[model samples]
Target: MVQSGNQNKRETDGGTSLESYTVRDPERFALNLARALEEAGKAAAAWSRPREAGEKPDTMAEPLADMVKTFSKLTEYWMSDPARALEAQTRLFSSYMGIWANSIRRMSGEPAEGEPVEPEAGDKRFQDPDWATHAFFDFLKQAYLVTSRWASDLVENAEGLDEQSRHKARFYVRQVSEALSPTNFIMTNPQLLRETFESDGENLVRGMRMLAEDIAAGKGELRLRQSDYSKFELGRNLATTPGKVVARSDLAEIIQYAPASQTVLRRPLLIVPPWINKFYVLDLNPERSFIRWAVEQGHTVFVVSWVNPDERHGNKGWDEYFREGIEFGLDTIAERTGERQVNVLGYCVGGTLLAASLALMAQETDDRIASATLLTTQVDFTHAGDLKVFADEEQVEAIDRAMKEKGYLEGSRMATAFNMLRARDLIWPYVVNNYLRGRDPLPFDLLYWNADSTRMAAANHSYYLRNCYLENNLAKGRATLCGKRLSLAEVKVPVYNLATIEDHIAPAKSVFTGSRLFGGPVEFVLAGSGHIAGVVNPPGLNKYQHWIGGALGESLEGWLETAQAAAGSWWPHWQAWIEKLDDTRVPARKLDRRKKMLGEAPGEYVRARV
Candidate 1:
């Protein structure tokens, strides 16, 4: 099992053995209260400001107004449906009373009816032995659960808010509730108390130091334990696959892997990974490297390593990415391999760009692309998942202004937004371990790669938000790139699409919608796991399963119903499909150099920090 410095300690008495139960520094609480009051006063002043004639309104104003209107309607509904409200109140009261009665019975050494209450599977706060036997702790835990359940029910039953508004409201309510949990405070958490007693309050001092260091490291608001970059060096332990940088441009570097097989497919494979992250994710370690796997499968593999943008690239737009990134990658691959046609695979945002490029290529009657594969990509952003919360007009405008000032969106800023989506898993765990409990975060390869994000150009990011997220022009056939209007329907190449069931960034259903937009023969695969896991799924791990079906017709539900379940990674299936596309095998050709070879694989561009 993985070890943690802040793991809970067991007491000899079978109860929490703490020398002190109260906080040692009461002045800290006072300071916190004063800070909160000052912030509240500032907010009140800001709220009182009058709107300018043509100035845009505050982004939060509409949501706050909707919440007020929702509460008003809820009040009326509660009055109209007295019985329902009464029943809800009665249930809440009964739940509290039941906890109290159980506590009393346990205190008196009497057996209570049924089993004692246990925390939910995801809740690790009450896992301490004290909560199981201590009457006060047990009661507190039960009370919190009952109240949390009541609040959730109230939000679920609330009326007047549209689906989007309700979702936002629920998400915010969850954040508030999570923040108020007892585990976050030193007084209530057994782990914190235990650490304090064991370290004689040194743990808290160290925690404060750590917090200061984090703030100094430019993560004050995000509260994440910054990954130590020195631990994992690129092209050493991380991106270790042997390859050569065959071509370079302002936007990307093309890495062509050395062939593992005696003969390879005539048509080379070109991979387009998202520019928001380094390309090493696909070429991580030899065992988990999809690039290595494809090379082993006897297909010549080529991947695009996107440049981490800076001020110099602030003016680059989607048109530039298409012209200098994807198009350039394809041309370089064809030129090096001396092949007229190539198979292409795009992952996440790269897939979106690839689809747009294909549409433009089709419009111009360019038929170089033989087949297309999109991994966890969304072309139709109508239901683009939780990330849409950050794509609103006001939020986008604010981001645009920030990008204008900085020349690009900072990597840390984008990472923070993504972490908020799964805060419990990605954010709070680090806060508790690194700040509250004074423990260092475990070294995780995926998390390290995730933290190593890249910045986006200001013009490109703004256009992406407005055109893709805000207006959804690509699906409607109105998106223009490089002076050409493009549509997904115009692309007639054979397509293979993959979506993960639990992907929060690109919802499977949204991905499913893209399959319908294709006019050519399409194969849709549904893998089990989140966005990264599903895409990086290697064979023989037996970690997750995937589903495949015939053409996805008009409905996602119908496609799922007719899909066939498979017990292994979808990589083998993808290989089978690729093999069928081309049967002519030729001897593997070595890189001829001829001024095309730039350097070794996992080149210098990926190492450029934002």
Candidate 2:
């Protein structure tokens, strides 16, 4: 009964036409509508089911609601005029088919009409010659890329969802599309396929064995290939710098490195590393060791080695880290070095604690802190980066509940979260290499230290999440520590702040913003690479570069625009700055035998495993 002219015209126009396929039969359209609704209902029921403990609650509810509204509108259009509904369905199919056809044409040596589909700059999987030479594989790669773009466009344009919800939708969609890439699959991946055939299908058998081994290891997910944990021992190869633990507490130990210079700065240096990981990250390998480098620069260095906390230490709070950790270390350094004032440095979360400790010290008119250096630390949570996605009230509460059950946050859990942020680089490579290729993981010093994680006390972690992240209390000067209200503005010591350009954990912008919060003259430096690499960068390698601004500006953009790029490491620059502040040079002093010595350089606490 309906006119077939539009349908024929659309078909004749090829896949480029946006006209819907005309449904000549009304009953058929009604039946399709019923089937779609039935499937949606089933999906809704499944989504509503109770989730397992520690599982992240679904964030797709709003997006799913928007989808349901779209479907309902389409259903109404079908009921009113089945022909229009058919046209809508046809238009959607044609759009997708057109995309595939264009990809095919490009793969077949036909020039593409618009800009060519290019892989993301960082994605190098398709850079191989086979991907370009082989038409079939090239088509697969192009098709997947085009599909991902189309999906992203749809999510970006979707209506009825809030900004945050839309962001969540886009992120999840990207993750899903990336996971489904042809390069990830054995059959579609040219390299993997060739390797499989060359190995006579032995790779598949080995992959199966590798997967079973991972499961048996009780990690429940494949992370890395079987690593020889014994090869990279602490205090031997890594964290091998010559030092001695002079003081010990339940929370931390102060290690005083033997000076490498004839004359050292009269004021000693105390390093406070994040309790989230072992302290030896600063002292890892003599060549790349920051502590050793400082000692060589004629600055007596002392590091706080935090205890790998357990259920018994679950009740420890931020106060303990300040009173028994930073303050205690400062006291020990002053006692051993006979220096009334000591230069202080803090890394990541340790910087946050140091900032609070300085504020507390200022409140009581304590003048022990001569200067402070903050490395890749964020006191302001306003722009804390992608990690903010997990800082929502619901997510934080869920984390708290999980931590309560275990009495502490498991290191493996935190590692997994950090890995997810860079899954393409950190996670999936291991998946393909360890499982698909069935190869053992190569031993790397950095990866070995990264694998050695530490648990966080529940009370301390919860307070940090609530006050620092969720509430933005620290930046607002509302954060309370050590039974005193602390303010960064009150701590008026000279401050040197370092931020990494590619750091995801503590974004450079966030760090820069926090640097401005200090009441004193602040020197903010932007380094290349990520969090760890930026801090551990040495002079000789001349690998990544850094940027230094002449003057601290009000905005990060303005500062970056005025900054100048420098070759080599930022270590020398930092050393020069600290030396300028410290004019008192005295002969290097030996450790007093009267002081109680805890143990050797990489203390017993550093050896504790999660």
Candidate 3:
């Protein structure tokens, strides 16, 4: 028990008792303290050796510098008028005073006055009982929340700032706020502090050792461990949908899965998975594998397993990828299966490339593709979420300069960018769990695939950023592809567009708007979760939900007003759509018939780690 008055007294730290801060095991702590120092030395060695060996990247982005400049704009707006600056200061100071008063009342066994500050529902940061029940922690939590929220609002409501500046300000604020959270520090975090006391600081010693190991693993960079990577291997356990590598190109390998059904659909399906990551996301395990499920559904599935690009593919642009990747897949499919026209499915960047390819095909009167399905793909990047913040001209130019020297962008750069999109969930938790808690992460297949990143070819990534993001060219029917103007409006293939309702990479509104670009009948469907879970959800799992409606309206909100909701995965609904288009059947095509078997499925390309 502690008294509220005289906070500076030795017996109390504000309202928390000084006596309560005692280590339960003093002898254990005394022994572990030396070990903790030794571990700290190891962590320092791990950091310095990479720089000494010149292994540290010279072109690593200076985000902090950019953040400083972005925040300065917000600083200017608030400081322009003395009265405005004073008002802002007053607002913050008032919130602090309220928190102090509330803390005193709480110590005296009284209710808080109207709850001046509280964490929003679903925010897991302040979930500890001490954060609410204890006076000091509760005050600290409320004070931090109020100040951070106020800071964010200042940026959001700032006038005389351009859209881009405003956006950068908001993003930077969030990054700063999250980084500065009290929970991140052992001193401020009750749980971490308690753990340290109980473990006699041995937790920190082990965490430091792991931190050193992770730094060493990343080769001078921090590769935050989200899962036990040792628990997974492609083709062995993860990408285990039995398949053969029927074809290989400079950019991709074509894998034809074994048909489970004796008779399969005549129209063979080719999946173009994003080259930014491995193809195993769709085929993580037998139960969650869409590839395995599709084979069970009597479809001859062939997937494009893209190469982990390097210096050799530096100059490979969008056209080359269109030619060497998709065209190569089409050629091999025709030769191996004797099917000219095929059904196609593309995920993420693969979907964007496929849509553009179909558009290019439309122009050349090439009708090889019968129908198309795009999974969480964006043709228009207007509402593409936080990713657009990094695609600005300045940042894109910096990426260009870096890529020019290195030949290709490092896989970790893209991985970091994607992680930033959901940092509260993806980044900090791992930081706390892996480093603070001194524990190996539990085995999770999706996270394992997420960590297994792939490099981006220079020219291809640049063109994509400029055309799709910097300019809304593809949606506007002005994007040039293969020495010809590309128009999504010209693409007449029946399209099935899937968008995750909670997608940060590709917002449903953006997908719904882009649907209007297609010349053919576009069936816009909304899945239940975010990008990965939304698309990879298998029907047999009996999880999540989906929405399919009569027709899309001018706006997403208008369409959702009338859209019908159905429980479970969207895969069966998509398969049903495929049947409605063309359901011809033929004997399952043997894999080793036409093209020589180059390798096994989940090819050697995916095995290349950066």
Candidate 4:
């Protein structure tokens, strides 16, 4: 062996020289290791720290306890029947035998089983070549997939379990299986193992350092950084569409975007985004910004920027948001543009609020909103997807009690729950990148927006969980707002409903079902992707397809069977629909110079960090 003066330049196995690894400084590595240890200690201490006087105790424990109890019932069903338990055990054991047989055949250089157990298509976790080529990794991958499948089937066929209980079981089972994946560990994952060898344990040091920092950033909870957050700032790289805050209230701020065209639609467009997150998602950037796109399309766009609620907003329920937020926007538009009949769009929870308020207003004979566009919104919560697992009576009650302590639920809690919805993509990838691989994530605008969460007011959140999720009062026409019982049947405005095919939060089925609740002519358009991507899809990018001209039948499957798939973004179709309703062009209105400006485009309400 010829040893060079530069020790890192030495050849690896088989005399093939691999490139020198990045972490060659032992002193630096040692220092980082010490720091990482210190941070980890701090993380543990933070977790153990007692709550101050009057501080809210984490409400998650009761829910977790309930989950365990539910699981026990499921277990009892299987355990009660020896034959059933044996059958389940045999199925898993049989799969293991097949995997073992395949391994033996591969070692003997014979053909392996043609139909071997494999990860489902597009399963990114087992994408590495070694997972396919190497015996050890292949076995591990197959074993994991098999076990996860077995557990899933057990829950699926579990007798006498209610839908909610079944839903919770499926969600938690997936979460547990995802958490226990072989790829997450350094020893099991070929890529991480190779990295470990090349770096000489330097990666571990750096990963631990990041681990400590993330825990601290989350204030004892692990706030997984999906992207390099330092690269972003509000109004700098993001939310840059030129505009001004024309209206402000306790609940929300109204931003009137600068008109991109000389002439704009006579009817102004009011966007009400979900208060759970900031409004900037619709206006993320120039390319993906719906506000900028709509402005360029000759429409005056006004968006409601909900204030990140605190204890002061604790009592602000659905009624208050309707009056102060949506009603306020309509009033502002009328005063500024003298256009009372405005086209309105609502996204997610904001959409639900818009529908409810429209019902209330229709009852009062208020014809302020002319047409409505709902984006991935749900008026019904019967099939509200995995999020329902968190909205049961016990959990909601617990959340309400905990929220009352501080008058609001913590923003991080909401962020965590949403992440849990797509844990494999949102949670584990960040874990592997930040903690296991010792690497910071790339700078992404959407992820940056996702991390920026908003607290829920106690009253508003309580009403939402109980009415929409628990009781499903909104869909049943029993949801009372102001002095009247709200019903979607009373609103006669033309509605444009957009649902994404792959939305986890608001399932396409759920969205389709909610469309039937509207009394007016509802044009249900199905977009190609998930919640955010489906809506923010720009026409220039031409990424996904949209399904139109399908009859809204009783079942989502029946509609999909007959739905016509059209290429490109659904924006153009929506624009055409709006034009059909009313396309009278008027000279674009400018912000009033005589009136006071609350702030700039993105507004101070959105800039609220906490």
Candidate 5:
């Protein structure tokens, strides 16, 4: 029995010895080397002939093929890990140098103007697939070849590497080489490539100097341009509708815009834009501007521009926003226009506030408002989407802490947050492309507009996040505004609500759900595309999708009963609905102003940096 036990222990020890063997089998190594050599010979033979007769392969193909051969050779050169340190250090230095060079190019904006940056497609120098899809692929090809040679050398020298370590090192080397490939350069550094080409290789230093000079010149020009209201003159036939500064409130300085065009509506129109951003989003350039479009549409247009918040207004809350911002602006428009009942168009957040104002007006029997049109507005907060993520207690508190220190939330901070939501699509892809590819991205006006941003008052942001998003009281008919328990059900005026299907901020379902809360006739429209484009969408540019509901009788149930379905851009449909309310075509009279002129068109507050 002792002899048998000793024999068993010897057998077990023998098995363990085989497992613990560190050296690779000589025969296996020889066989792998032979196979690799055979493959390389075959590849060389294949390379000698054309894949297609008289058609040349890309310049990168040969280098890439050679790199592949080198990689295969590396797999067979297994050696101790520590013995490969010098080779590894050399590769590391090369990689570090490459990265440093790329960084310098980015900081200085060097590569863009100096050369024909290669296509990003098939480039490995970039980290993102989008960057790889750009036009700078050739630059990536060159970078890859050099990186591959260095990596292959590192793999060839070694002494103590086990199978696992060798395999891991080989794989990582291949990956890193592929990532840094000249072909991949476009993909890796798309932003750099794009910017380089676009700017014609203008360095950052030169660009900054030019920018400073231009800004200084612009400032001087602007100072001379800005004077008395009457002294200022517009270059184009732009807006025949003379605008007069009517009233100045705590938060907004109201201006009544009266167009000289033929009128198709009896009641005057008052445009209420959200205070969250500068009101000029509606009054942008003459062609695409909604305000300009309204004037061309022969409607009596009036816009209320809000006073941007600063340190002095840090403590102002929602109550102040309502009483001072909304009510004050409305009264001024009413007084200046002499129109007892004005048709109101409230866009985005301003629409919600407009609804609240209507409820307040109903309570006070205020007959100034005739009809209300809400564009891309949300009263329901149950599904406000990602914006609600910031509504959590912890996040909100953190934001408040940051805002408290700054007095107001920075516009750049807001822009950064929204940009992060689509970092790959909106931000990072361009960065990698321009910085890595040594090119310039396409300059898009819409992108430029999207880039422009403004800050939100800390007090307003806090209250809005808490009351509307977290508590969700607005849709519940329990929201209090200006010391009144505002109820959507109490609003009996004709209501027109426009929504978009792909709106990231306000989903259509949320907007539709709140339809039940309104007591009067409700027309809910679900437009195609996203929040901004859908609202600004004009006919013939793109087709829009929407659903229409019949007029809501006095009861909410009655509205749901007649709520029929339809489809198309709600603009025309909305136009028809609004047309029905006008009754007669009344000539637009010039609006009257009570207060003396203070500043220019698009008041100083609108121009103020938040």
Candidate 6:
């Protein structure tokens, strides 16, 4: 069990125990406030810098910087109560000066050099008396509402506290109450606040100063906005993995990775990657890459790198994706590897396509697939969580309208929606650190990977939303792919279902339910971490923990009740499972090149860039 911060503190005779509460470190809070204030100063200096000295400053920065400066000065006043209120008076002076200066600029409609300035519709400082009154009244309304709620809750909760605890609580509550008066909130939030105040008070200023120093020293440089392309390189093992132009009706290109000197195994492994992102996610880096590990374990790996969609592919639907994506790729992998049966691994949306292909293959009696592995994929969308929030008719209509204007769904827009689902962690935290703190966010490899996005054909996305997410037809066995009824129950091959316990996107229960949708022998494994981290989990790391239970027949809840602790990564466990199904103990056999002439490996379709 994870320990609470005050775990060591014992309970007292009073109703409130010290162990039950955790106090914020005053010193740390003060230090953080100081850092934030420093940052505010640097931001102010940056705003004041001449256009030639600094790249043209953002028009938004000047007002925000001006408010931040006022907030800092106010904080300086608070540092020593009754210090003649000298800094407080100066802060008031700066705030009014900023307001009047902005007013003059608005009246003139131009800068000193006759340069035209952008009009501010939301600017609070207007010469019109009515405008200022309305803004101030609205600000006071929100502030009073918040202040009343906070005060009431504190009073109600404090009634049960002991003398000592109650006194501390009262002090904190009073401090908060005084801080919320229309004057304080504005002082704290500054630009948005009714008055000039720090967003995080002193901490924001101090952090900003440190960040400014780092930037000056070429360490933590801030980027106000994000870029479309990422700097990360896609790692490669095959020399012929680069894309080349291909003609219509050409055989799909295949990239194979595995160890040398092994006979063609009976079960070749095929990987289906989501077109929403690049195929490199499976082969991210040598250390954590699933493809690299699979090849090293002596399995012939074949991955399909999808063509990034464009206006020309707008008419392409799920039917086309199945034909060119799975069916064609399967045929190519089989013919090249000389294998009668193969193992397939599907990820996210790719898993949905794979399920459809498997149904089609089964209907045709293809006998090429020996087993199938799905990673955090859903066959049932009934309990899909937040993704369900976006599946309504109105939402679908809105999507259709937007897609009609643009042939393909913009990749960045889709990324934005996904990121919004976890705004606090995914968006705001980074915004505060990078923009407000003046520091560059830590470079996370997974986030870098997520940054790499690709467009989806309009038809493909529409069909997926209607059939898979909204209708929930796939799990119900009412879905049809390529005009053929596709049933999950029919694609009954040895299956491996892996889900992360803490996965927000695809919960373990949802993944577990997907197993019941199939009539195959299933092994459901639960891993640690979220969707991405759980998959890319590498071995040999200390403090890494995961729980494992019995295969499909066992209840997941029952297993969790008696689950055993396992050391190291679950990769070895997966490797063992794959080995048991291997009829041939030998390595993979090399395939003849240029059998069908898919132009070249990778293909131009996969290389299309924004």
Query: Highest lDDT among the candidates is held by which one?
Result: 4
Highest TM-score: give the candidate number: 3
Model 5: runs farther than 4 Å from truth?
1-242, 437-444, 540-542, 550-569, 591-595
Candidate 6 residue-wise lDDT, 342-364, digit = tens: 88888878887887778878888
Per-residue lDDT of candidate 2, residues 1-610 (tens digit): 2336555454211222212223345565455445544544543333343343324344345434544554454345345667755665565566557656766775565865655467888897787565665555666777788778766765565555555555555556666677788888877887776665455445655665666655434334333543555578888899988889999999888899887888989999999999888887887788888888888888888999999999988889999988889989888987898788999999999999999888889898999999999999999988887667566677788778778876798887677667767767777777787767767788777777877889989999998999988899999989998788878999899999999999989999999989878888898999999999998998977878889964577778889889999987999899888989976899997777687887898889988886
Candidate 1: pairs in clash: none
The candidate, 1 or 5, that scores higher on TM-score is: 1
lDDT values, one for every candidate: 0.79, 0.77, 0.87, 0.88, 0.59, 0.60
lDDT of 5 by residue, 1-610 (tens): 1123334334211122211112134454355445544544543444434434433223334334543554455544533355455566666676645645654564454553343333346433344343323222323443555557666566545455554344435544654554444332322343433343333334232333333332243331101111122322222222223465566777877766657576646676778888776666665456546776666566767777777777777888778877887677667666655567778989888887888788878888887788899887878887565566445565567678767975777665566555544443554444433333323446544554454456778898787777787787887767787788888888999999887777767776666666667778877766778877778765545466665664533543354467654554466677678778875676766553344665546565665652
lDDT of 3 at 486: 88
Candidate 4 yields a Cα-based lDDT of: 0.88
User: Model 1, 326-408: lDDT tens per residue?
Assistant: 89988898788889799999999999999999999999999989999999999999879778766777678878887887689
Q: Per model, state how many residue pairs clash.
A: 0, 1, 0, 0, 72, 25
lDDT of 4 by residue, 422-511 (tens): 999999988988887889899999999999988999999999999999999999988999878988999899999999999999999999
Task: Name the lDDT of candidate 3.
Answer: 0.87
- Best-to-worst order by lDDT is 4, 3, 1, 2, 6, 5
Q: What TM-score would every model get versus the actual structure?
A: 0.86, 0.83, 0.95, 0.94, 0.60, 0.62
Mark the 10 consecutive residues where model 3 has the least summed lDDT.
1-10
Q: Which residue pairs in candidate 4 have backbone atoms (N, alpha carbon, C) closer than 3 angstroms, thus clashing?
A: none
Which pairs clash (backbone N, Cα, C closer than 3 Å) in model 3?
Answer: none
**What is the model-wide C-alpha lDDT for candidate 6?**
0.60
| Model 3 vs. true fold: TM | 0.95
Q: What is the per-residue lDDT of model 3 for residues 282-309, given as tens digits with 9 covering 90 to 100? A: 9999999999999999999999989899
